[model samples]
Each structure stands twice: as structure tokens, then as C-alpha cells.
Target: MKLPTDIQILEKIYKAHKNDFEQYENDNSIRDNKIFVRVDLLKIAQELKVDKDIVFGRLYYHLNHKFNYQNAGNSHVKLFINRGDYGKDEKGHEINFPYMTSILAGMQYERRKYQMATIIAIISLAVSTISVTISVFL
Candidate 1:
């Protein structure tokens, strides 16, 4: 049997989980603005009678070109198709998934590093103030 196109697969998964998407949208508990659709690699592979890796490879090939893929734990993957829809820069060009993911990950790492440095500086200043106070008392 011929394999389905990436768009076809995405449509099938979305159709199958329409209720889930709607429920998620209606869920006020979720504060995150980003929405994603999850697809179970194993389930798709079984439905298509193809190897799981092959299915994943096909998805990677198509999605990497436009959408970011996040391994959502277990055998499922999250699709961030909106990333492609939104323009990243002034030029209105969408960055590919691999590069965009890496850039975002790097930004996150830098933010964490800045936070850690701020914490350490605060602690160091506190220690120095305590030492000066003790010296003054002595």
C-alpha cells in the first residue's frame, strides 16, 4: 500500500483527535498559549502496517522542513505546526524546525545561566555583607 503524505497523516490524526483538541482549547487550567497536536508513532505505524521508524522518518522528513517536532514522551510526538505559520523575523521567513528548535533551546539555556548568575551574585553579596558586619563587631 502506498504511504500517506505528511499532510494526509496530519489530517488523519487531527480528525481522530478533534475532541481532544477542542477540550484542550476549552480547558482554562492550561495557561500556556502554545497549542500542539500529539501523534502516537506506534499507533500510526500499526494502522499503516509500516515500521515505526519508517513512519517517524517520513514525519521527520516532512515536518523538519516546516514544523517543529517535540518528543512528547512515551511513543508519542508533539507537532508544533504553528511555528511555521508565524513569522520569526522582520523578513517574514519561517526558520526550519531543527534550526529553530536549536535557537530556542540556546535562548532558554542562556536565560537559565543568567538566572543562575544572578542567584550566585546575590548569595556572594550577602556573604560579603555578613563578613563585614562580623569584622566591624570584632
Candidate 2:
């Protein structure tokens, strides 16, 4: 019933909702799996018994270009240009599904940045604690 923090997690919750029901007639494919497109956010919230804002925030975080809403109407307004990762345009630009993986990866590049930072912090903390202990003893 708890709110999902990230898009990938939210997607999992959506799938769970889809599975419990029997009326899903269409699907949105992710890799080999067909993630159903028939999403009912209100129903999902009711089923999970979570707050609407939390679920909505999760949905908005993803569908709104990963919170890239700086410009009020920056995204494609026309329906044809809003094909997303589902089709090819006139220029043969085959859009691929960049969800789950790409959004999380991005061009940030530093994959293990947090792990390295944590190691450095722990080392510094230990060294400082040792220095303080020595000064106290002295």
C-alpha cells in the first residue's frame, strides 16, 4: 500500500494492478514482456489503498518527461509527434523503449559514484574518530 518512489517501482505496481483484473485487452511491450497499457490510476490507488497524490506523483514523474516540465508546453502538442517509443516517424527514426533502464542510467556515466563516496566517507569518519580519541588521551 506504500507509495512507490521511482518510475520503475511504480511500473511494477501498475503491473500488479493489471494482473488482478481481467479486462486488459491491449499491452505496451517492455522487452519481451507486454506491460499492459490499460492503466486506471484511481482503481490502482483504491486497490492498493494508497493516497491518490502519491500514485499521481509517481505517474507524473514518469509521463512528464522525467519531471522535465520547466517549459509549460515544451513537449509535443500534436498527437502524431507524441508517438513516444512505439513507432517510426517519416524519417525512419525507430523510437526505442528507453524506460526503466535509460531513465535510470542516463548520461550521468558514474555508475558506482555512490559506492565510492560512501567508502571515502567511512574512511574519513574513522580517521577523524581516531584523531579525536588520541587528542583526548593526550
Candidate 3:
């Protein structure tokens, strides 16, 4: 039998724990702070009749690369699954671009700062070498 796709596996897990997942999502105490639904991975695995490792590997890969979902904590134990479009606008477009943009901008700023520091270090070295040579000649 063919293995299920990552999305299919996730769907199965959601279906198996529909009530828990929905309750978790609807609970302001949980959803107000975090955009994740905590679920027991071992239970989901047993319900789907799949190995826990396979489920974890697929979930991790999809979360990081495809942005279909985000997960926290260990899949072998429990996991918090957050939808990619959790905070999207009504039209399904991301409404929080400023937050993500600020993050990218911060990363770029750090990169530029490092580049400038390296340039300054090289120039300082060059000046120090020149001064040493002049002292030797004097």
C-alpha cells in the first residue's frame, strides 16, 4: 500500500481528534495567546495505524518547507499544530505582513552590520600594519 501524503496524514489526525482540536481552537485561553491546537501524537499515530516516526518526519518537513502548518514540542509526545493561515484576512491573504516584514528586515540589518564590522576590522588591520612598517623604518 502507498504511504499517505503529509496533508492526508494531517487530515486523518485532525479527523480523529476533531472535538479536541476544535475545542482547543475555540478556547480563548489557548487561542488568544497561541495559534496552535495541542494534540497527542501517539494517539493520532495509533488511530491512523502509522508509525510515529514517519508521522513526525513528514509533519516536520511540511511545517518548515511548505508552511502548511507549524508545530511546537515533540511529536513523539505531544505537538501543537498551528495553521499557516491562522491569522489571515477574510480573502485568505496574510494580514500580518508587517510582523513578518519586520523580522526579515531585522535579519537583513544584522547581516549588513556584520559586513560593516568586517570591513572596519580589515581597515584597522591595514592601518596597524602600515604603522608597524613605518616604526621599523624610522
Better-scoring candidate (TM-score), 2 or 3 = 2
lDDT of each: 0.53, 0.44, 0.50
The alpha-carbon deviation from the true structure for residue 115 of candidate 2, after best TM-score superposition, in angstroms, is 5.2
Model 1 lDDT per residue over 35-75, tens place: 44444556667777777666666655555545444565644
Distance from true location, Cα of 22 in model 3, Å: 3.0
lDDT agreement of model 2 with the native: 0.44
Give Cα distance to truth, residue 38, candidate 2, Å: 4.8
What local lDDT does model 1 show for residue 3?
74
Q: What's each prediction's TM-score?
A: 0.40, 0.40, 0.39
Clash number for each model: 0, 0, 0
- Candidate 3, residues 1-138, lDDT tens digits: the string is 456555455556555545543564467664433324444555666766777656555655543344432347533321333334333312221112222233335556777899999999999999999999999999
For this target, which candidate reaches the highest lDDT against the unseen true structure? 1
TM-score of 3: 0.39
lDDT of 2 by residue, 1-138 (tens): 455445444444435544533333343233222322333445556765776555554554444454333347665321011223313322311111233234445423343686689899999999999999999999
Q: Candidate 3 local accuracy as lDDT? A: 0.50
Better of 1 and 3 by TM-score: 1
